[model samples]
Target: MKPVLLSVLALSGLLSTSCRQTTSQAPSQAEINAIGLKRGSITMCGPAQGQKLGTASFGTSCPAAAQPDFNLALSLLHSFEYDEAEKVFARVIAREPGCAMAYWGVAMCSYHPLWTPPSPAELTKGAKAIALAQRLAGKTNREAAYIRALAAFYQDWNRTEHKVRALRFEQAMAAVHAQYPQDSEATLFYALALDAAADPADKTFVKQKKAGFLLQALYPGQPHHPGILHYLIHTYDYPELARLALPAARQYASVAPSSAHALHMPSHIFTRLGLWDECIASNRAATESARCYAASAGLPGHWDEELHGLDYLTYAYLQQGQNQLARAQWQYLDTIRRVSPVNFKVAYAYAAIPARYVLENRLWQQAAHLPRHPGPLDWQQYPWQAGIIHFTRALGQAHLGQPDSARREVAALRGLHSELVRQKDAYKATQVRIQLLAAEAWTLLAEGKAAAAEQRMRQATDLEDHTEKHPVTPGEVLPARELLADMLLQRHRPQEALAAYEANLIKHPNRLNGLRGAATAAAQSGETAKAARYRKQLRKLAPVAPNPEAAAAHLSSYRRP
Candidate 1:
């Protein structure tokens, strides 16, 4: 699962940091051939309504196919368009009376964010729906089998215990994948389950390897397949592999402009390659197409799901130093938040806007506050959101000279994994665990335990490396490297710090933090001229003076040594 919070850097920002380029053995033709690539858009056999039902329409009958409104409703529920999806399903229940999918769709859609879950009532309705869908499964066909599998998935999703729900969802998804291996939707959904698992530290490694094997066996050229490139780019730094994937990512985005998954990615690659013009152009095109999608949906009287596009565009703007455009976009996001206020989706808008400003202006204190919430908001309840907030809190507190408070906040966040499992938030719980490992390692580094910290940090990075193959952002990995580099420098391991910083620079050369870290490492290692050169680059990049020693002192203000 790409940490959604990482949208801050995916689009266009350039890191003016260190330079360490290491070449690896080029990918062999056989290795490249193993990446089963899909051509054109994700092909679905259902109906035109099936696509909408699959992607959007869930609640009501929006004229999907002929007989089975329930089937169409099932498709909509799978795509997460719960409101309209639910209405369609309710109609099916009214007519068929015992149609199991209708009840299942109700359950699935009920738990969906579009409808919002405030109390346990929604959970009950979802359970009832799941029971109905299961009962209806007694009499079925190929379509019914597929639908039944989905019903099981949703039922498991709503279970109060996250671990159980995740396992059930995984089982259902696995069944679907086994039965219909060619079903990209099934495969993608299965991947999503892996992405959401509670203890994915190991599972991510296992799943990505599995996904790679499966992708090779089933489809070979669909580089644009949602998660394949994400996995490869993040896990290893094989430039040849990334080069081979370039065409696939580009073609995928071109073919499926409206797909949120497809649009931001090619642009992401472009950003990484320092192709500013290409990144900006792709973002512009994506933003335009997303606008059209929102207009057509006509939900909430505006674009309902284009936050993804807006996020991409925001990153693009920040990277190009088009802060003015980024500010305008932030304002627009604020207006949308005020007018719509749908779910926690707006937190991206709120968090990103200020984060960009803080980063750009070097306002560490302000940035720190943006990520700390007094309590979980509706969206903040997500494991990913909770992780992001906690990380942000750590970052803010660290910058504000409160390492002790930062340590405690991070510890409290680590405790959320247990609660997450209890709350049936398996997907989020797993992600949080990954972050917690990284955060704890950083805390140990701050506490001057270099050897122990490095061990934990490497473990965290290794797990991230194993899973980098699935479709998720590599932001966490970059930060982990940076923290390690800083730790190495503090421990007088300048060579190791330099090596790590250089490696990260290859992946994210424009990151100001990486640049700053390189400069600081150089200075501490007695390489004055090298340090001076990096400092010049850093100043050009961020133009701020952050005295680490002074910052450390400030950290003392918030908590104990």
Candidate 2:
């Protein structure tokens, strides 16, 4: 998987790639009974039923059926019946030397759970299969393009040949679409390749123009493929997809009833929409789907949601202010890491969950416990990984009033950004730039350097109000502005603080922090009546038990600054 293909976007997220495709032919009736295709359809292509066949909608034609045993092997292999899958795969390859599906079967066997460690025999088998697929692809059908793509994906897990592999997969998708324009699966995978290729240079400056290829395939009249539906809902920003997201999420839940990935859209959409109850319902359904993941992993007793399902369940709880539960989940993940810290697949989850906790809950001590260092640039797993922990630690330290330490962190981040730019790491550089601005402003604020803080804050604002131009999202603007406003108020610039606070409230009208800051500034400037009104609003927004002594303590603390 490429950096774009990390687990965050794995099933139903804004950055996930399209589903992996297959070219293994359907088995005969006898073989179907032998491998249990008759039992039920194997879920190879996302939450959908059955392997999506070729793109021909007009007629069902078996161009030339590959060996039934190979099909049986592939079917079983896909379904996680490893022993049976291997036996059948071997039987097929032994008879048909150049059959692409046979080779596909061997490559797929590595994906099985029972095949514990990557054995030398299995590695040799996979290598041979990839070689055979590459060698014979010219003579094979274009549908076999997906077979080669999978083979290539398996061969280069570290993505040494990422560009070539992705290019080949994209071409294969194009071929499939050309042959079967009506085929939903072909269209879905084509959209995925388009979405996956999004990080590359666009060659055009148009809103949604670059992704039109994917968008067209997903609209009604085409098959409502679960993978396409998930991509549309999960991978795109909330504002970009908000209007259509709710309905699409419902359709997804219906189509992918048993899929945990199905619940991500609804949970996330509801959270953005501020509908807490609906978000909770969707997350509960997602937790149930964790059972499916355990079964797939051959760990029936395991109930770890992070391993098999999206972390939206945890995210939903955090969004609703359930910090205790979120911490419990983090502790559980920590235990898992203690057992096997080398599980690279869950690396993003390990970093992201704790980072969110630190940022949202202001937990500096806990964040310090989490990993904040990056690997060598060449060993980078995710683009966000290129600087996420560093940027987060800088902000967290700034919030905790450690300006000197925060300045060092921010400077280090700036160095990373400069290096990324010098080396043309565009996406990573863009991400780091946003954090650099934030870290710079935050450090100045922490150090009580109001003038310097205002300067850096202005520079940050010049970049973009929303995440479109910078890495920071629009939702964060109000909060950042409020923090800046408080800093000004503390520096005895009440008038300027009033303007900043007003701007923040305008950006995010209902946020409690903006109201609190506005009220405090009004009170500080001796506008008793206006301060009282703002205080009333704040109480309505976020009521806390009355504690006069504590309030007086806070008032005295602010007067000290």
Cα miss at 432, model 2 (Å)?
A: 3.4
Question: Which digits, one per residue and each the tens of the lDDT, describe model 2 over residues 185-293?
Answer: 5565565555444432332313234344455445565334555555555434344444455665566666555444455445555545545456557766665555554
> How close to the true structure is residue 557 of candidate 2, measured as C-alpha lDDT?
28
lDDT of each: 0.50, 0.51
Q: lDDT of candidate 2?
A: 0.51
TM-scores for every candidate against the unseen true structure: 0.58, 0.61
TM-score of 2: 0.61
- Predicted structure 1: lDDT: 0.50
The alpha-carbon RMSD values of the candidates against the true structure, listed in the order shown, are 14.9, 9.8
Using lDDT as the measure, the top candidate is 2
Q: Mind giving the per-residue lDDT tens digits that candidate 1 earns over 126-244? A: 65555444444233343344345444434434333434444445555566677776666566556545444424345335654555455444336554343444333222222223454
